[model samples]
Target: MAEELLFTVDGPKAVPARRISLAEAGLLERQHLQQWVIDHPELIGNGVKIVTFEFDRWVSGAGSAAADRLDVLGIDRTGRLVVVELKRDRAPDTVTMQAINYAAMVRRFSLDTLADVHAAYLGGSTTADEALARLMEWAEGVSDETLSPPRIVLMASDFGPTVTNTALFLYEAGIDIRLLRYQLYETAAGEKMLSVAQLLPVPDAEEFMVRPRSSSATQAASRKSGERRAAAAQRLIAHELIPDGTSLTVTMPNLVGQDRDAIRAWLDAEPDRARVRWYNDLTAPVEWEHDGQRYRLIGLIRTIIESATGKPPQAQIWPTAWYCIDDGRTLNQIADPLP
Candidate 1:
């Protein structure tokens, strides 16, 4: 794939900005780039939300390796762990091996350990309970007892053939791996800019999704999720806590990437307007106020996501993604008090 070319529009003319490197721009790996990623994780991909920044606190069970630091730890919508490794320049061939080692180490992490790290990373900006709640919310329905293999993401100015080749091989072998090439550009006014691209996966990030297996366990989980939602909806309906036609605002969780931007833009364009309404159907309780179409809570979120991202979001718990416009209570929260 061709590298991206960015142009600045001066009145009516489009002028191309000269591409530069991190070195030329005088940016440090940890101080500048890494911190930027820690602040705004979309530099990697919006799908993978940052869990903690700069995790280095690891002790080898075998006592063979020294203290190794993972640049960033994240989790996707599907509950898989994301291990991000960064380099300021062209990545050395050893980055692939290093990222693999990092993934190996984190793959064994318990959700408790993850929550602890997240709480520490929050640095008292929020309470422990709030941090844990945020972490579990991002984890979706992934329980503490279950853990999935970590996905490796390598971000750098470029990757050599060795790294790219190994990434392709790992991906083909069913290992979740992605390479993001960081490009640097300088404008005519001497201002610096940066751009990142998914090199190996190349182009769109949504195409390479983590496919869930069709096992009996997965089927059972899906069925249980459906039943849980149905019961909650029924309880809400019975209690009259959410009367029919109760206006609702779609309450999105922490979002990143282009789709998130699209949704935010649409939402900020209309803050007071409620796009969703409560209906009488137990299986499908939410109505689109604009179109008058009824849909399940998950389906409404999915529709908005599909409209924004041009595809459905990864599987996640959606009952709490929206809330009452008047009371600001979620469906699950409203159902919690019902006897």
Candidate 2:
């Protein structure tokens, strides 16, 4: 059972201390708890950010029909997807199976598709691509290819032995899942306190039970790639190329006949800048354009050398830098870190 806090009155003062719950407090309706967690995801656990709520996945076939919906979907800093299932009162015996099914469905989601779901959940405040970029940054460039399996989280006011045993069996069999129990308490002044606890695998058993699989060579390669991407993102942030809230338009002049050393020197002098890509005549840029304003630099040469010479741009002279930024949408979506 989760622990609760109790207050004692001492002459003109009240002191609070920890106290284990002897009996279950009044239950919070599932919808209320869902909304609360949606508003405050940290209540679910540390480093968790709710990506979308009430996600619906249609599962219909020619002869069979079923509607599949997830209560909440989240992702951690390492890009591991979290599938959260919530129950208000007692958790049913089949809850573990239900969460497993949801995890199976969610594990196949690509980065772009996850971003689309998040954008829709945000009511179209930002484009899917931009949201995805931010998520990647938060995930420290943990690439989709290297993302771990989806983690199943079962949250309920209470769990029966059957559900606990089932969860334990799955965990022992190498499924990444956890159970969190929520308990609510009321104070003399009618103030409410909520306590959450991780029940399955307990704290001490986590190290042995949740270690990553043995794929040393593959993991090393993936880590190297992730590090490179993370470094690039950090450089972009440091150089202010990717401003936090405002959109930017970066223009680079064509370096056809320009002095390579001088251009390199100029680029080096710029603070917080990193080389993102080198574009040649054959290299096609994304066709989409920024919506509001168009900024153009005067005397800028626009010829693609590859086009003129019928050859690719020389690696030494390629001159295009790419940076990403949000598009006017507010992202107060994640929980603030615990103090």
Candidate 3:
């Protein structure tokens, strides 16, 4: 079974909002953006620090600068000079020719020309000498023979057929031209989000890279080899003993003698951790008279640890093992346990 309640209501239809014009929109002027860059002007890329943003007249040997509100000129930290032309809505009629003229102007800029531009742009804050020096430094790896070309950057919301065709043609003709598409997004809270929606140099998109595993592996191996070599050196020094009364002399067989001399000389220079022991392999019984007790090096190590720490070690502590002296055959055979 189904039951229903009825209600009647009348409402007026609402009209859709009209699209905003470019002027009505809160789009920032290209000059305003340039000023923003000049103020902060610290563009970073690939962990590199860039410190300058500048503009110059587009066509070389033809003008001082593009007429005001006509075109903008600039250089990035990479020492790459850029010419920017902005269209209010669709592509402007003269933008292609304008950008071409600007590129030509950039070609004429030499060290002196760049210095003049910097001084004009930065005002009394910079001297021509300092600006020229910086330009030379930036030009270190750049070839002096060829006329350094400039990159062309076009900013617009939409491109007309002629502008699009021109840009495409110039790009294929080996001109470094890029189109940046700017878009506006509005939030429900009446907030606007202006963003760079697309860029023409598609392959040069931002990316993140991590260190390769092989590099870490190589570093780890190097560290291990260093530790092993250090351990071997320390063990060689440990096998040597200083001679009695003779501060510069040591008692060691001339066979393993170099380390012994080194230790003896070091001790004479500085008596640190000083001790003396006869050279006897652990396999061969060593008899040492300590407090009328015949203690082997192994027995001495055990007794020292037991008395110092007041704890019984699990294994019978012994001196480090080496081959037997008698036959140099059976290695590290413990003689008889303490009877």
Candidate 4:
């Protein structure tokens, strides 16, 4: 296939903008892409949220390379890990398999580790607990247990048939992999512009693919969300992971600009879907105290998010908000640390 051309119209005079390699625009370095992605992950994929950049902390097993590095790691709204691999030009056929391998490695990353890594990425602009809270805000259901079966996103100027074919196969086989074509355009003023377009899993097809799962799967997931919250609460309190009466602080603020109408709509959607009921009453005790009030971690965050987003927390609030005043780790980190 032939490459597409781009132009800049300056008051009826159209000047051709040459499409070139990322290297030509000084964007081929790993950090160039990593930091840029860390700053603006929206450029990568839909609902993609950047977690950390330059993740390579894994120790090599028998068949793995010791120095393997993941360029950009992110997550989606659903909490699946997103492995973003950046290429300067045409993506090599091996990139897809390589990204899959990185996904396998990242599957082991704990919620705590992600928070710590994001802290380092932030260069101490904020506390790790705050970073974890923000991460939770970005990927609502993200937690140690929620991270799994990572997704892959390949970005480059073009893709050969082999890479696209492999990605298509993976997508159909239940692996969520996507291909993005990036074109680097140089304007007449020496400014560089980037165009990112989805290559595989066409948007309409993707919507069809992302439909509600089989009834069994849907029921199981809905049930799991509720059960997981209860189990985590029971395990934490019973095991004294975080002893009762601990004075916890809101690591982040409550959902400001809360929309009552959206909240009402969310509460009305999908009557049969199971969700852990939140303590709608602000006065109820949650087992953790803030200003002489007892509250459960999940319950408190749910109240906050529901007020803010008009939706049930669905484990979204647990690991993200609220931190121990003494230890500074978020509730979920203490309750569900990675093994």
Which residues of candidate 2, in runs, are more than 4 Å off? 1-5, 8-30, 60-65, 203-272, 275-339
Worst 10 residues of 4 by lDDT: 272-281
Q: Give TM-scores for every candidate, taking all chains together and pairing residue i with residue i.
A: 0.60, 0.57, 0.44, 0.60
Give lDDT per model, in order: 0.70, 0.56, 0.43, 0.64
Better of 3 and 4 by TM-score: 4
lDDT of 1 at 245: 87
User: For residues 1-339, what per-residue lDDT tens digits would candidate 4 score against the true structure?
Assistant: 356788999798999998878777777547565566677888887678777777777777675556888888887765667899988778888998899989888888888788878778777476666567667655544678767767788887788777776675577556767888878789989988877788777744333333333445533553444232322333354465544344455444254334545554644553322122222222232543223344444445655456548555433244333444456665456656532
1-339 in candidate 1: lDDT tens per residue? 356899889799998999888878888999999988988888888866788877888877686665788899988755678899999898998999999999888888877677778778887665554455565455443444334577789999887767776775566555768899888899888888888888766434223334323345533553454232224565676667766887887866654323667766666666533478887665567877756888766556656656666754543344554555566766667777775
Q: Give per-residue CA lDDT, model 3, range 1-339, as digits (tens).
A: 011222222366333233333466655555544443344333111211122344534442354545534245555423455566655566685788878876776677664566666656556777765554344333221222222466677776565556655665565445767766554444444554444433454543211112212334543553453231111112223343212121111122223312344434533553321232333332212333233343333344344334434533322121433212333321122222111
Off by over 4 Å in 4: 61-65, 125-127, 203-339
TM-score of candidate 3 against the unseen true structure = 0.44
Sort by lDDT, top down from the best: 1, 4, 2, 3
Runs in model 1 lying further than 4 Å from the true structure:
62-65, 125-127, 203-339
lDDT of 4 at 191: 86
Q: Against the correct fold, how does model 2 do in TM-score?
A: 0.57
